[model samples]
Target: MEDPYEILGVKRDASTEEIRSAYRKLAKLHHPDLNPGKKEAEDRFKAVSAAYDLLSDPEKRGRFDRGEIDASGQERPPERQFYRDFGEGPGGQKYRAGAHFDQEDLSSIFEQAFRQRGGPGAGGHRSFNMRGADAHYGLSVSFLDAASGAKRRLTLPDGQMLDVNIPAGLQSGQVLRLAGKGMPGYGDGEAGDALIEITVEPHAFFERDGNNVRLILPVTLKEAVLGAKVEVPTVKGPVHLTIPPNSTSGTKLRLKGRGIRGADQYVELKVALPTEEEIELETFLKNWEPKHPFDPRKHMRGR
Candidate 1:
């Protein structure tokens, strides 16, 4: 495995915040959801995550720096051992390979011969059960999908498919766990889980505030001046909204229970004028005079 520092593109003496920032930047770039169907990017994302995992842990980082553990976080074998079990023994009895022997005895002999090999299976140890490592993945969903709940099939890096169920009102950065979807276990142990981190994509016109939805609704000048009922969009669907007469830009209105989880939807009205020149309207405005003069900027001046 490549060095964690090199993978994250950080200096050996980088601070925690610096490492975190680097990881975040790389993660954002190589996130699988952002680079769909790109195997290289997905692999890079996994490597970055693993690197950050090792460096973020103080104990692991210290061990790695001290040469006690490798870049993969596995312990390094000692340089020398007291006894050499592979070659000639003290009495000149040699252990030769490819020689037929009892299954139990061969297992014991191999374990003893390779005692320096680290982890559960080595070191002359008896058979043991070990749970598999959990697999991590990133998934991206649309804002509406997250708000309304939906089912999506995710294609893993290994080409395996998993159906993910997104719950209603699911927020960004939420995690969903799939049991037994990770690597295989050892010696009858249970398989690990697959942890999928969800990222919610932003909408062009809609914004979320907690459970409530916010939208900037553009209205014509005539519609704003004379009350009109317009069809507005909500998480559930499009609904008619009543616009009050003489409403100006920045006017706010609310639609009850139109947002995620029964939350309200707030619409801020923006009065938009016609793009082309309106000869009649311009002439009317020039000749028209209000009975009550109003200063729109009065509140901003001294109040």
Candidate 2:
């Protein structure tokens, strides 16, 4: 596998936001849906996703930087230490290079250590049964899917497919644990869990606030002036929203229980005029006389 930084075209010292931005651009360009039936694009997309999976994690990134792990996220062998690497003990005793040790000697050394703490191997033989380490993974989901609750199948770097259930109103940085889905355990111990971190892609039209949803809906000038029921989009689907008469830009309307879970959706109305000029409308406005003429910037006058 290529270095994650090089794969994402980011420098080693790049900021988190910079790395994320690069990955997003590459992911979009090589996404399978955007390039259907193109094997090259699909491969590139997978590589980009994998690279992001490693670099986006702080612990993994630090380990990789310290040479404790590889680009593929696998652990590297620890550097070997010899007698010369050790210093003198409290009694000025130095480690002897010619000294030999066997499995029984190591077990007895551990036995004494456990005996002091009254651990499992204090009185009996050492079991040495240990649980495996937990596995970490990353998954990306659409905004609607995250808000509405959906199931996704994640492909791990090892080519394993794992089913993931995203709960409704799931926030970013939340982890999902799959029991016994991690690395194999030693001896008779059980396996560890699989920790999956989710990243929700931003929607082009909707913004999330807590569990609530926000949107800026464009209404025609006539509709704003005369009032009408228009189809508005929600995370679930489109619903009819009533625009009050004389509605103007920045007028906020609430759709109860239309957001993620039981939260509400806020729609701000923006009155949009005709793209082409209307001679009749222009003439009417020119001769229009307002019954109540008030300063539009009255608040600005005092300041």
Candidate 3:
């Protein structure tokens, strides 16, 4: 493990926004999907994620900066105690252990150390143990898939296929927790949880604002003037929309419950004229005028 700031390529005094920006840049560059079959990139992505997790947490970052904890968020042992237990021997020689380190046994030892040193709790009586590392996965969903909710499959680091049920109205950056699906536990501890982040792809014609979906629909000049039923696209499917007679180019129409749940759908009118017949239409309208031909911009003229 390395310093989180170093891992994220940020200064120790970097602002929250700067930290987040750096993390996002690094994460995207090293994401497994972007670097398929590249183990090094995957590892870097994990490191970047871990760094962001610690730095994003105010309490953890403060503790880390104050030397109260190590880069892995583990409590740092007292200088004197650490030296007494695992310091180098005379002549700069290191001591070798006879047996292999058992993870469960090591966890128990660390737990005992925490209890003895009054970790987390104020008093030394409370027992505290570290949870297994949390796992993170990025999920990509289509606009309709996000709106309608869908089941998605993710390949985890352990080569396991995890099925995630995305709920309706899910937004980008929303995290879904899958309990006991992360790193394996040590001793009798429970497994860590998985954190899946949502990323909805951009739609070709629809845009999301909060839970609302907005669309710009093109209508012919005749359709706008005469009023007609035109097909409009929605999250569900294409449906017929009525264009009111004399509707303006910027007029807005509403389709209730057609967007993501908890929001409404808005359709903005974009009146499109037939370019090929423009000359003929202009010539025909040369002598024609509106019955109430008032200057719409009259009020804007300077006195």
Scored by TM-score, the top model is 3
Q: In candidate 2, what are the lDDT values of residues 221-250, reduced to their tens digit?
A: 999999999999999899999999989899
Residue pair clashes in candidate 1: none
The pairs that clash in candidate 2 are none
Instruction: Give TM-scores for every candidate, taking all chains together and pairing residue i with residue i.
Output: 0.74, 0.67, 0.77
Which of the predicted structures, 2 or 3, would earn the higher lDDT when compared with the native?
Answer: 2
lDDT of candidate 1 over 1-303, digit per residue (tens): 799999999999999979877876887898776798888998998788778767876877998999888987665753233235445654987655564568996666556535434335544445545566566666779999999999999876555789999999998867798999876787777997887778899999999999999999999999999999999999899999999999999999999999999999999999999999999999999999999999978889965
TM-score of 3: 0.77
The local lDDT score (0 to 100) that residue 39 gets in candidate 2 is 81
lDDT of 3: 0.80
In model 2, where do residues sit more than 4 Å from their true spots? 1-95, 99-127
Worst 10 residues of 1 by lDDT: 77-86
